[model samples]
Target: MTVHSALPDAGWAFTDDAGPAVTRLLDTLPVRPRLLGLGEPIHGEELFLRVRNRLLRHLVEHEGYRSIALESDCLAGLVVDEYVAGGPGSLDDVMARGISHGWGAFAGNRELVAWMREYNQGRPDGDRLRFYGFDAPTEMMYAQSPRHSLTEVRDHLTAWGDAGQLPDDAALIDDLAGADDRWTDEAAAMDPSRSVGSSPEAVRLRLLADDLRALLMAQAPRLLATAPEADRWRARLHARAASGLLRYHAVMAAASPSRYARLMVTRDTMMAENLLGIAAREADRGPTLVFAHNAHLQREEGHWRSDYLDQALIWWTAGAIAAAELGDRYAFVATAVGAIHHRGLGAPAADTLEGVLSTLPDDPYLLAGRRLATALRTADLAPVRRSDNTDDHGFFPRDPAHIADSDGILFLRDVPTDKP
Candidate 1:
């Protein structure tokens, strides 16, 4: 069933008014979602980021959003948050220390950070914008060792109360952790046999992590009472990161058939936890704008074909889990582009969503979720394009079935890189 001819008229109807376009899209949502997620089909494209920056400005200025969370390392994001909140630091240093995945070098990100700092200047603490990274510390190339988080939690706790109250096992954890190179071995990603997950040291470390987590929970009341609220919050963050990173490492070392699946799920689980924590900390004060890839923020099950494993794996995204927990309070707006000249992508096929959207003028627009879904269901939406080159690949199809799961769509008829 080719949708090339049966496709609905361009229902987006957005024109020169980008702000109003965004407003109309948000109005269609069943509820005002707290987490207003904006997903880019590809990464590091200045076009997408520029649109994102525009929409984010509108959301913050008009819609009362106070925080912006990215797909970078959650723990490392503290440096960014501090800078944005009026802490002292040069832009260059903040960008270097704050962003991960080597994204600090992005022109769009640099612009975004600079704008954030400028916007924050002279603003009261209550009015200052916050920045965050909701991703786990782990990356595709390396899963971070648990030492940092564990040590942080221990140090924070020790500062507030009796040092003896906490377990005295830093040396043991260090020994068990071994060299960072072992945990970061790229070969271990494909060959489970190469993983040290099943090693006796790893098993023991898991037990220790569980105990430490339990101890944190058990001692929370006392810890909170004795420490400043700020200190307590920081301690909790460390505890959660410590426990979560340990679990991630444990999964990485697993010899089970489901190791990879568990590993993916674990990463998203931690992402969800971090996002929820961000939401909880802020409460009903102000909305948050989350920036990530479409896969991480979409409500549908995320699928990726593992080149090494020779099979596809499906996992729940952070957005999917948040929707289950937050319901209508979580909203998502996925960005799709019609063309990316650098990546061999051209105009969208008439049957595809991008193609359908291409009929509109060359500008950023937002489409109603239900309307887009209806059009897609009738138009025979294209199949999803699974690839390892997600950062650079421009063409990605949207499964029509998942359209309704999103709150809205942000479409750009053409994507041009901001690179020199």
Candidate 2:
């Protein structure tokens, strides 16, 4: 490895002039991925987001990628989509309401949103870019009330020239939802006693949500046939949001031993569905750029330790499922960082993925995972994993075995943070 430690000439330097690099990477791919996921090691890093933004632009301009998805609330992303597509809304309001998990405040996300809006200016609908959030609307801190999604579905149906076909009571969903506090209780995440998932109201709501979902699906053909293409898409989104939120609420109210795991899996499952939906709608238009954490986008099984439960949790990620379903049409590039500020992470020790990549004399670069893994094997340096000592939610270990499963790896030597 030392022989090739001086950064192989095959990798592309991370810079503003990344169009050629992206083109090369796309051309070199054994299979064209309809969903090209760019995974980040950590969140809130401005550099990572900006780099992703640049790459997305390149894919859109050159490779004809039409959609950009992120690790954000699927329902909330509608506001963002509307804004980017020249809808009525101020940037501040869109940032506040369109983004979830408090990510809208990040300078990187703000810049991306602004640039997307600017890019859409004067572009025809066919040439315009679409923004989407692939995560469930609920958060780890507190799940949002399912009222918005449920009511949105009802309202859309009512306007569809068939209010009589649905439930007569406008207050039915609100009444069933009850107080938002019941679902958003923070302690319920770990303590079964605090959860109301099995409550009678919740059970009833589940049944009703199911009925509503079935009704929407049954009527979809007729509704879609009568409406314009855009209206049809909007109607489908409303249906998805309603059903997805109901399912999320049902999970939130669960009091089982596997509640947390179910929630985790459910969130990712929703993400996968949303992604596939986008692919179905826009695959003909272009590929999609999915920006998310490595854990959510990796093809390998995801691993994490829960401090609340004092045990490890492992599950399949959205990317893995997509890869399985899409076959070679889903490509993933996991980002590995060598150092981070505030978390005390610095120059990775040799033997680790970061450490091995750090040997290459580049601030940032893209390495073909298989080639890099081969080089590591040649140098007799086994790739090591990162430790889970810090409480950083963005941190995850990159097992070397994942190289065979991944299309490429985006390596950053250091992460820039707001440390003074």
Candidate 3:
């Protein structure tokens, strides 16, 4: 069967090799989303990042994509965005300060930013590419201080907001924030008692965060009239970070059984909001390519289990939220990898989705979501074998059920993590 044609009867046949021919696969999607999400099975894999760069380059050249959003810090991304848009700064400097969660250390990310900058040389604004970091600044067991976001929004209000609506004393926010360690304490994640979120000062800060958000909205007309695009974006970004951190801290202080569940849900909610904002901003320019973990971008409810949690937590992911609102305008393409020998991961079991794809000659094959799921299933959906690789590496195997949940799947025979 040709790559351009539909699935065959004798088993799935390769068509496009997940290269520039990815355009063919994307053209088959039901709708061209303003935000096209590409999810990876794990983070920090050089191969996945490189593949994303390649696919996005193709999309920019062939499909008119103008922006790329990553799972890094939204606030930190602005620096990278500015650099890519011809702002002054060396690539090394931008990589260190512009990317969060230590993702800048990855060579692949540096290449992506450098390429975006090079691509923008002498190009007009509309045709030049854009960059964004959509994930909240929260981690599994560590959440950052909300002081910067809180203070930034507060400053914005003082500069533009009406006096009567503003906080009585601007310094109060700084006082309430107390110390950075109170919020950044790693122990707070596993033990809520260590959190200062429910303290009197922290509660006041939460209320202040809410007030700041409302004030920004109420004064949007005045602010927008006076503020430039960058100012407006920064104000909104600060507002989002402030609000998200307050909510996350509140969860951290709760000694309830659903602590981790609430934390995970809160983090993804922030991601979803940022994604929606990106969609709105890029609606006129062109489509965007969002890259993140498979769990964050899948349309199905996110589920996780660990010794820390008593029950299996199921919550809506960013993709589910975006899909509910954007409908056909949001599409998810999941990447299924065959093996990463370096991580002790071997070839996929013949019964698994990755295993089935390993049988094909195409190193990377683009398969239809629903059709492939049906073809691979006999009676009920057989579970995709969970990775036998050590858990410390953070590898997640394809959940057979999720293959049908996605709009498409890009299967790779090997990630070449050992590097050629």
Question: Best by lDDT, which number?
Answer: 3
**Model 3, 1-420: lDDT tens per residue?**
432132333223333334445665566678778889999887778888888888888888878899999999898899999999999989999999888888898988999999999999999988889899999987667887889898898888777767567877556877778788889899998788999888887778888888888888999998888777678778888889988988898999999988778888999999999999899988988999999998899998887655335578888999999999999899998888888777777887666667666666555666768767666655343475665654643566668776777877877778775532
Give the clashing residue pairs of candidate 2, or none: 1-379, 197-253, 197-254, 351-384
Instruction: Give lDDT tens digits, candidate 2, residues 63-125.
Output: 889889999988789889999999998999999999998989887888889989999999999
* Error in Å for residue 14 of model 3: 8.7
Q: Count the clashes in each prediction.
A: 1, 4, 1
Q: Pick out the ten consecutive residues of candidate 2 with the lowest summed lDDT.
A: 380-389
Q: Rank the candidates by lDDT, best first.
A: 3, 2, 1
What candidate 3 gets wrong by more than 4 Å, as runs, is: 1-20, 307-311, 377-381
Off by over 4 Å in 1: 1-17, 161-164, 168-172, 385-395
Q: Tens-digit lDDT track for model 1 on 223-323?
A: 77788765676666776776777777667666777777788899898889888888887675698899999888999998876656666779999999988
Candidate 2: lDDT over CA atoms?
0.77
lDDT of 1: 0.75
Best of the two (2, 3) by lDDT: 3
Model 3 has an lDDT value of 0.81
Instruction: List TM-score per model, in order.
Output: 0.89, 0.92, 0.92
In angstroms, the error of model 2 at 241 is 3.5
